[model samples]
Target: MQQRTLDILDKVLYGLIIALFVVIPFSEAGINIFAGLILIVLVATFVITRSVRGLDRGIWQPILALLIAGLLSLFFAADKGRGLHKFLSPLVKYVTVFVAVALTARTDSRRRWLTAIMLVTGLISAGYGIYQYGWLSIRRVYSFSYNPNVVAGYFAVLTALSVGLLTGVKSRLWQFVFSCTTLLGLGATVVTFSRGAIIGLVASGFVLFTMLMSKAKNKKAVLVVSLIICVVLVALTPDMLFQRFRQIADLENSSNRQRILLWQTAWDMFLDSPIVGQGPGGFSAQYEKFRLPGAGDFVSAHSVFLQVLAELGLLGFGACLWLGVLICRVIYAQLSTSDQDLEFGISLGTLLAAVTVLIHGLVDTAFLRTLVGTSMCCLAGLAYSIGLHHKDESSETVSP
Candidate 1:
C-alpha cells in the first residue's frame, strides 16, 4: 500500500510538470497562480509522506544546501526582510520541483515521457513566438515575453534540451522530433531578438557537436551538415537575423549602451556591499540612487553571476559554483555509463538543458522569474535521479 501511494504521487508529479508548461503562458492571468496552488498541495502531500519515511534526505540535498545559503546570506544582507523573502520565494518552488522529478524519474518510461512533454511544449511555444515575431508584426526588436532577455534566456535552455536528446534518445521518431524542435525553437529564439540567447545557443551547439561527434567518427559529418544548414538559414534570412544582430554592439546599439550602464551600476553595488551586500531584493530598490542620469529604469544585473554576487555575496556565489560542478559531474556520469540507451539519452538531454541555463545564467539573471525557476529545479532533479539510479538495478526512475 505504501509503495502504491508512492507510485501515484510520482505520476501526479510528472503530470504537474507537464501542466506547468501549459500554465506558463497564462501565468500573469491569475490562473497560473491558482494552478500553482494545486501543485503546492500535491508537493505537500508527497513531502509529508516522504519526510515521515525519512528517505528524502539524499534526494533533497541541493535544496538543503541552498536553504542553508539563503538563510546565511540574509544575515549579511543590507535589508534583512528583502533578502530573506527573495531567497526563500524561489527556493520553495524549486524544492518542490526537485522532489517531484527526483521521485518520478526512477523508471525509463517516465523519463522518456518527461522528455517528450518538454519537446511538445517547446515546439508549441516556439510556434507562438514565430507568429508573434513574424506574422503578427509584433516587432520583436527587444523580446517577445515581458522582457526580451527572458525570451533568450528561456530559449537557450530549451534549445539545449532539444540538442541533448539528439544523441541520447533511441527512437527514430523522437530523434526527428528533437531535430525539428531544435530548428524551430532556435529559429524562434533568434526572431525573439535575444542576442544573449544567441550566445548561449552557440555555446550549446558547440558543446552538442563536440560531445555527440567526438566519439562517433561517422557522425562528425552529420554535425558538419547540421551546422551548414543553420548557417544557410541564417544567411538566407540575414535581414530578419540582422535585426537582432544590430543591437548587440555597444557602438551600434542603444540597448547595448544601456546594458553597459546597468552592468557598471551592478558592479558598484557589489563593491559597496562586497561582503553582505544589499538584500537579495534590494538591487532594484536601491538602483535609482546609483543609476546613470540617462539610463532608464533601475533594473537587475543582466548577468546571473553578478546578480548572485550583488544579492547573496561571496558565499552564495561559492554555493552556486559548487552546484554547477555537481551538475556537470552527474552529466559526465550519465555519458560514461553504457547500459541503458534511453536513460543515457534522457540524461544527456536533461544535462544539456541545465548547461544551457548555467551558461545563459552567467549572462542573464534567468532565474529572477518563476518560469525558469520551476524548470531549472525540475531539471536538477532529473539529473540527480539519473546519477543515483545508474548503479541501482533494483530502482529506476523514468525520464528521457
Candidate 2:
C-alpha cells in the first residue's frame, strides 16, 4: 500500500512539473502557486515516508554546499529580509524542483518523457513569440516573459532542446517535428534581437556539432561541410540580425555604454565588502551610492559570475564554482558511459544546452529570472539523475 501511494505521488509530481511549464506563459501567480504546491508535496512525502528514496547523493552534494553557503551569507547580508525573501528563497525553490525531479525521474523512460514535455512547451512558447512578430509586428518580441532578453534566453535553451530531440529521437515523424521546432525556435530567438542569446546559441551549436562528430567515421569531411554551411548561413543572415551583431563591437551604442557603467558599479560594490560583499539581494539597494550619471536604471550586475561574487562574496563565488565543476563532471560521465545512441544524443544535447546558459551568463543575468532559472535547474537535476542511474546500471553489469 505504501509503495503504491509513492508510485502515485511520482506521477502526480511529473504532471505538476509539466503544468508548471504550460502555465509559465500565462501568469506569474500561476507559476508561483504551482511551485509552492510542488514544495508542499515534496516536503509532505519526505516527512511521511521518513526516507528520501533515489536522492542521488552525488548530485545533491554541490547543491547542499551552495545552500549552506547562502545560509551563512545571510549573517553578513546588507538587507537580510530582502536576501532571504528575494534571493535565497527563490534559490531554495529552484533546488526543491531540482531535487524533486531527481528523486522522482529515476528511470530512462521517465526522463525522456519529461524532456519531451519541456520541448513541446518550448515550441508553444516559440509559437507565441512568432505570432507576436508576424501578426502584432512587435519590434522585439518578448512573448509572455518580462523582457526580450529573458525570452531570448529561454528560447536559447529551447533551441538546444529542440536539437536534442531531433538528434536523440529515432522516429521519423518526431524528428521532423523537432526539426521544424528547432527552426521556429531559432527564428523566435533571432527576432528578440538579443545579442547575448544569439552568441550563446551559436556557441551551443558548435558544442553539439563537435560532440556528435567526435566518433563519426569521417570527422574531417563532416567538419569541412559544417564550416561551409555555417559560412553560407552567415552570408544569408537577415540584415537586421547583422546590425545587432555589429552593435556588439560598438561601445558608442547606448546599451553597451550602460552595461559598462553597470559593471563598474558592480566592481565597486565588491571592493566595499570584498568578503561576503553586499550579500544576496543587496545589489539593488546598494548600487545607488555607486551609480554613475547617465548610467540609466539598473539593478543587477548583468553577469552571473559578477553577481555571485558581488553579492555572496568569495565564499558564494567558490560555492557556485564548485557547483559548476560537479555539473560538468556528471555530464562528462553520462556522455562517456552512455551505451545507447539515444542516450548519447540526449546527453550531448543536454550538455550543450547547459553550455549555452553558461556562455550567455557572461553578458547577462540569464539565470536570475524565475522562468529561465527554474527550467534550467530542473533540466540539470534531471540530467544528473539520469546519469547516476546509468552509472549504477553499468556497474551492476560489470560486477558479475
- The residue-by-residue lDDT of candidate 2 on 245-321, one tens digit each, is 88889999998898888888888888887777687777887787878888888888888878777787787788778
RMSD of each: 4.1, 2.4
What tens-digit string does per-residue lDDT give for candidate 1 at 131-162?
77677787672233576667656665667777
Cα lDDT of candidate 1 equals: 0.65
Alpha carbon deviation, residue 73, candidate 2 (Å): 1.9
Candidate models: Cα lDDT each: 0.65, 0.78
Which ranges in model 2 have alpha carbons more than 4 Å from their true place? Answer: 1-5, 49-51, 391-400
Candidate 2 weakest ten by summed lDDT: 340-349
TM-score of each: 0.84, 0.92
- Residue pairs with backbone overlap in model 2: none
